[model samples]
Target: MERWVGKVAIVTGASSGIGESIAEKLVKAGVLVVGLARRVENIEANAKKLATCKGKLYAMKCDMTKEEDIINVFQWTTKNVSLVHILVNNAGGNPGTTLIDGDASRWRQCFETNIIGLLTATREAIKIMRDNNIEGQIVNISSVLAHSNWYFPTINAFDDGFV
Candidate 1:
């Protein structure tokens, strides 16, 4: 972590939960963190709380389900911040609907966010790393549900792919 001081990282779904925790820790290690999420205000609020930390946090509005939003965030980061040295793909969720009775539209939303979005972000981050010749890190956060026998039809179905 000390080696990452003054480096740059992008963390998706950083508005709350595990994403928020990751961002906080990275910032404390003196890494500049860009928190990307639809709840930009939440990230901004947390940024304020961490202003005195060794690093800094910037909030960006991003809807992972939208490819354009994902692309734009990376572009914005390169132009506004330094090239990214780390990427934490921590954004994912189910619609809380069971497979048998779930709406197709909701299911599509879940797949778009939990699967396609992650792929897109990882591809973009890799491009940046390759172009800059930086041996950066990419962390994909997956739930224990992926490996469990406990069935959460909506969640396990998607999360399982990560493992």
Candidate 2:
């Protein structure tokens, strides 16, 4: 973490859970952290509590499912701060849909957010890293559901197509 001082790290879904925790840790370590989520206010609240930290936390509204929002996030970040040095593909959701009985839209939504959205953000982050020669790093946060064999029949949730 000390090595990341003054570097820029982007954490998606930073409004809560692991993303929020990571953001807090990074700021304390002196790394500029951008917390992206639809609920930016939550991140803002957390940032206010971290005023004494070595680094800073910036809250940006971004819906990972939309390409426009993802693009806007990177564009705005690069234009304002320096190029991104780290990317955390931590924004992910599931529809709790079963393979035998489920809505197509729910599956589609999961696919868009968890798979396509992560890919898009990673690509953009890589471009920034390459263009700036930042030697950037990417951390993808996934769940135990990522394993295909872990299935619960009572919950009717399928682990397929999860990342």
- Enumerate clash totals for all models, in the order shown: 0, 0
Instruction: Give model 2's TM-score versus the native structure.
Output: 0.92
Q: Model 1 over residues 1-163: C-alpha lDDT tens digits?
A: 9878998999999999999999999999999999999999999999999999999999999999999999999999999989999999999986777767777787788789988899999999999999999999999998777655675565535442433
lDDT of 2: 0.86
Stretch of 10 with least lDDT, candidate 1: 154-163
Residue 59 CA displacement from its true place in model 2, Å:
0.3
Query: For candidate 2, what is the total of clashing residue pairs?
Result: 0
**Candidate 1: lDDT over CA atoms?**
0.90
RMSD of 1: 1.6
Q: Which numbered prediction scores highest in TM-score against the true structure? A: 1
Task: Quote the lDDT for 156 in model 2.
Answer: 33
Give the alpha carbon lDDT tens digit for every residue of 32-139 in model 2: 999999999999999999988999999999999899999999999988876899999888876776667878888787788888889999999999988888887999
- In model 2, where do residues sit more than 4 Å from their true spots? 154-161
Best by lDDT: 1
> What are the clashing pairs of model 1?
none
RMSD of each: 1.6, 2.1
True-vs-predicted CA distance for residue 147, candidate 1, Å: 2.2
